[model samples]
Target: MDGFLDGLESKMRAKTVRDIRALRSNANLLREPHSKSMGEGLFELRVRQANGIVRVFFFFFAGRRIVVLSGFVKKSQKTPRSELRRALRYKADWEERFGHGRS
Candidate 1:
């Protein structure tokens, strides 16, 4: 995710950071255009700028913490399966290390 953010252009990066802050502030208050669920405990934080759209995948962990898994720039109307798989893999790895679901 750090690499992803670093690769983004300045304006887009700033927008993405602002959107992420909004997500952290109140994920439940974020809906549609801003956030969307991918099912199976995964959600995407959507960040759109004049340049492009970005999606940061994350999941709620123990103590209601948001664990960001991966992020990618959206190049198509639909999200690529590979990215979803990658996020799921990260989620699995996190669960393995920290214990699944809520503590």
Candidate 2:
């Protein structure tokens, strides 16, 4: 996420940041071009800039807090399998330590 932000023009970067904030506030409220569910409790946040698209993969851990796993700029029509695995691994690790669906 940091690297993607660093590569963006300031204005577009600011918009990306705002979109992320909107996601943090209400992830469900922001969808499609902004957020997507990748199944197995993992999701991705999409940030569009004039230059290109950026995606941050994350998962909901205990208390429904968002834990960002990894990020990459979109290079192809698909989100890489490696990125999804990374997010799932993080989700697994989190569940291992904290237990699942605790409220």
Candidate 3:
């Protein structure tokens, strides 16, 4: 999340921050310019700027806290497989270290 926010211009950064706050209250907001499910239990928070698109990948934890696994600037229409893979890896690592993947 830090990485994604850092790469944005001032105006974009502000708008991104606002959208993220909204996501906290409602995970299933309007897609395209906000958030979307990426299969499994993973979701992506989308922040757009004229420069590019920034995405923060996250998943819910046992106590309903959002765990932000990875953030990156996306290019092109496709969400890069590598980025999704990294987020999935991080999510697994987090669960292993903490929740033990328990329900």
Candidate 4:
């Protein structure tokens, strides 16, 4: 996620960062245009700039915490399956490492 943010153009990166902060502030209340559900506990944080559209995949866990899985600069209308798979893999790894009963 850090790499993803770092790779963005300065303005886009700043905008994405602000969007992420907004997500942090209102994860439960966030809805379409800004965020959307991708099923299987996955949610997407959408960031659009003049350059392109970026997406960050995350899931709610450990009470109010949101676990970010993966991110990408969208190039098409539909998200690629490979990216989804990557995010799922990360989510599984996270569960294995920290999903244990800690809150």
Candidate 5:
């Protein structure tokens, strides 16, 4: 939870709530402990699918529920490393300026 992921949880929650009210109800269900599956705890990425595209998202569950860490629309070339770096930097700047998710 360093860069872009810092405040992403709140963004996803807010946007997910404001734009997709219907889906909002289902979000909690998606947060179930067993709902998330991962081989190792190193990465806990989640994919939100819509139409024909998939939006990649991660969660920070070092707390009560899964907090959406960050998100991006999947690209054909597998999400360039530069983009990942930028995302991380963005998260860092956000934290430096605003603080954390609650901000």
Candidate 6:
């Protein structure tokens, strides 16, 4: 899991890394309920996977062919407001760095 996630992490620049890691870990744990928040088309997309619920927020950089920014989780019945806020912050940061475009 580390190797796969590390590969994914390597493609990201510094600003979005933390959120990506959180998202990946959270995704792996998904079996519980969750929700996501979004603003300005940037989103924290939460979904239920086999293990639990994963929350990921991202904006893509089309030219880069990268997710640009993403994060996930597997615990918690509801996605916390603070975490969603953090993901939103990261999404903003990603837009700032990469300039939002079609993903």
- Top model by TM-score, which number? 1
TM-score for each candidate, following the candidate numbering:
0.94, 0.78, 0.80, 0.92, 0.36, 0.44
lDDT of each: 0.90, 0.78, 0.79, 0.87, 0.41, 0.49
lDDT of 3 by residue, 1-103 (tens): 6766776788878877786777677775457657888987899988877766778888888645677787777777889999999999998899888975446
Query: All candidates: CA RMSD in angstroms?
Result: 1.0, 2.3, 2.3, 1.6, 8.7, 9.5
lDDT of 5 by residue, 1-103 (tens): 3343343456454443342333234544554321343322212234443432223333333332334344454456355565455545555565567555441
- Pairs in steric clash, model 4: none
Question: Model 1, which residues run further than 4 Å from truth?
Answer: 101-103
Candidate 2, residue 103: the lDDT equals 79
Return the clash pairs for model 3, or none: none
Runs of candidate 5 with Cα error greater than 4 angstroms are 1-45, 48-50, 56-71, 100-103
Sort order, TM-score high to low: 1, 4, 3, 2, 6, 5
Candidate 3 overall lDDT versus native? 0.79
State candidate 6's TM-score: 0.44
lDDT of 3 at 51: 69
Q: Candidate 1's C-alpha lDDT?
A: 0.90
Give, for candidate 5, the lowest lDDT window spanning 10 residues. 34-43
User: Which is the winner by lDDT between candidate 2 and candidate 3?
Assistant: 3
Q: What is the lDDT of residue 48 in candidate 1?
A: 89
**Worst lDDT 10-window in candidate 3:** 24-33
Off by over 4 Å in 6: 1-37, 60-68, 100-103
Residue 35 CA displacement from its true place in model 6, Å = 9.6
Which candidate tops lDDT? 1
